[model samples]
Target: MTTAERSGAVQDPDARRLADLGYTSEFHRDMSLWANFSLGFTYLSPVVGVYTLFAVSLALAGPPMIWSLVIVGVGQLLVALVFGEIVSQYPIAGGLYPWARRLWGRRWAWLTGWVYAIALLVTIASVVYGAGPYVSSLLGLTVSTNTTIVCALVLIVLVTVINLGGTRVLAIAALIGFGTEILGALVVGGWLLLAEREHDLGVLFDSFGAAREGSYFAAFLAAGLIGIFQYYGFEACGDVAEEVPDASRRIPKAMRMTIYVGGAAATFVCLALVLAVPDFGAVISGENADPVGGVLSTAFGDTGAKIVLAVVLVSFLSCALSLQAAASRLMYSYARDRMLPGSGLLARFSRSRGVPPYTLLVAAVVPAVVVGVSRFSEDAIVKIVSFAVLGIYLAFQLVVLAALRARVKGWRPAGPFTLGRWGFAVNVAALVYGVAAIVNMVWPRTPDAPWYDDYLVLLSGVVVVGVGVVLMAVTRPYRHSDAAADDAVRSTAAPER
Candidate 1:
């Protein structure tokens, strides 16, 4: 039988189990496919993505960042298939953390949760850091270190307030942002492509030979690695499982749609930007403006560029809220299983409405810190955010691999989304793509590449993994056989008001 049919076939377990305690599976299924599509798009706006490509692909891979995006996109597609299988099966807000427990046993599950949690925290920082510069630029004010930090803190507080109100507010806000951002991006891209009709199409097509001052393949790889950030926010949907209207049916659909929407939107924006290829020598020349910032300036003039800047700023802020929402879930998920440091408080659902407030507080820290750091140095801020995002993607890919391994061994989940035999092939492709991206990001490019930045990504990832391992060693509770079963249901299944 198919996965959807299988869910109906399975019997619900007895209600008295401790694992079922206080879980809130209350997400509404009111979100349409487009809303789901925007969930990812809002995360991968043209403004932020352009900077990412310039740094990763153009700076390093020359024109190969385009190819890198293609490679990463394909890998993400396969990985999404894995996510499809899992989300369809579990449909819980906890996402990969719960899946890891079920597939790899509890210790491994907690380990997976640790990595995922840390990744989200880092992503929150990156999002805030990315946004602050855009905000500073749009306001025509010089960005100061203290100002950036304070703004980041404010952004976190704003996001926390929105999340506390729950899913309805987020979905509505996301829909509005998605529409505004998409129209702005298309207009900006259309102007660039149409106005620059005289520019060389050949440059856009054949720029691959123009590698940075490094190994050609390594440059290409690093650039492609950077594109991973373009695809970061899709997982945020999974984090809000408790708030999704019809989570079981909608979550997988939302996830798949997110990839399609983000890929198409990103592709359109890139094409427009590529057609207007700035002087490579000039762009790379010291003191040339941010290529993306420069391009928008050309396409819209000063006034229009600032408008685009505002949109980009809003896009990042949207992502900031989404990141906070996702991180809160991660904390709640970890605490739910007693994996994090403050399970009692962090795990507690509000007595008034059953929301987990303490966990939300914990998730607010990284973004606040990210904002503070951006004022010191934009370059350092960007690199730190990039490093953190890389760690998050790595964790995401690893969990997918672990889950795929279990599925290949004849494990089955009763869900609406299923890959069947194609699961293995798709999953393997995703695994390969993820591995390539990780290596690309870590590989050194040239003597010019800062030593601290070069090692920071590696060190941060190591620290996250080491912490997970240590926690596993100290807890010892995860060794139980029943922990591997990891079945959890809502404390009350009635639909949300």
Candidate 2:
């Protein structure tokens, strides 16, 4: 089928689309841009990205952690360009789902949306897990696994409350949290470097020899794949595309810019960590034990470190809130499309709050289950998160590649945020990187790691996508609403911006 035949038309073709979609276009384009960056950077800035960079840098690349960051950044940039092009053309909410449907056909589009939605749910779960350690550290208490699980639930509830309030509140919180996270990263990273000015830079830069001999390439590849998680959530911008003014142009520009900025910042922070904190042996060992908390403890001293830990805690909470905000909209979007089991329930948007409360509740449950399971074993939690990230990446790549194919076949729309003529080259690079990451993800480095767990995440992801496909397959044909269906799907299909 031609691209236009495959992808559904934008719902709400008229000016009253926002009212019909259960939201007002009250958010300005700048707020939309900041909100996207706020969610994207808060999760990475001084918290998640820091920990991962530290582990990989110390264990795999040494000071060259920047290399992995650069590689992953480039890889994501390619994908972001594709998103940029698509967002400019389709600038509605339910960004990827609609884009996928338009480019790949409705069946594949349904599957894409489902996979993206579940992937975010799993992200919320895992990021909540990342936050628990910081909460415990902030309070000066030792945390048992049980306590961690409890903390995770409390966080989930908190984020859920914020999300159910509406997009505006979430956007405001994201702005505040984004500033806090960036400042925290700077303070901690800069303090460490200046604090240890006498440390040997050569040692830090050349530490890759310490890993299993000849494993640098594999380690680098794995680290690069893992690094993709750091630069993610740009699509969250697309989830609320319909909520913004001039969405068609602004959404894609915001997405493309978000990747560039987030990637650059991530690169700088990784460099700072390697130069400042050369004790990879200790950091890696501690991360193996406690991940977020372990690294923060070593980076700053006891009295001062607690304050830093508080910043980290807030950052984690912000990330959880961001995920809920994005995921609920996704649920709302899917329900609007009649792609989910409880379409009626998820479709209920509170007039008073102007948000989808039931959808928020549904998104909360998935993370809750994952967090509960996490309490039983640390290894299990890590594997599940790793699997989930890989699954999300796979879905993103597929949608992206499909879009590129559509472009190749001469399906072009006028977009202010065009990637110029270089769009094809960028997409080709993205496709290559994505395929490599997927292949490398399934290959076990450690024997105890189950490939099936990866399959389980993929399978679950596939099932969610299938639900969307099934809705289209089983239901009677309803005329495309431009007002009701795909346009309403906005809450879920956002970019990382």
How high is each candidate's TM-score? 0.86, 0.84
Determine which window of 10 residues in candidate 1 has minimal summed lDDT. 488-497
Candidate RMSDs in order:
6.2, 6.7
- Clash count for each candidate, listed in order shown: 10, 25
Per-residue lDDT of candidate 2, residues 1-497 (tens digit): 25563242243342244443343332233346667667655544446655633554355555555566677777777887788777666655566766776576655666677777777888888888766766776776686777677788999989888877676777788888888877877777677666643255565456435455657666666555446667777777777776666666666766666677667666656655556553555554444533334445666668777888787778888877877777877767666766667677877777667677887897899899988987666465555566667767877887777867766665553455666667667778888988876676665566455665535544554565566566657762233313333321233332222
Q: Please report the candidate that would top TM-score against the real structure.
A: 1
lDDT of 1 by residue, 218-297 (tens): 55555665567777667766666655544656777777777777777777777677667666555544345467777778
Residue 469 in candidate 2, Cα distance off native in Å: 7.6
The residue-level lDDT of candidate 1 at 386 comes to: 59
Worst 10 residues of 2 by lDDT: 488-497
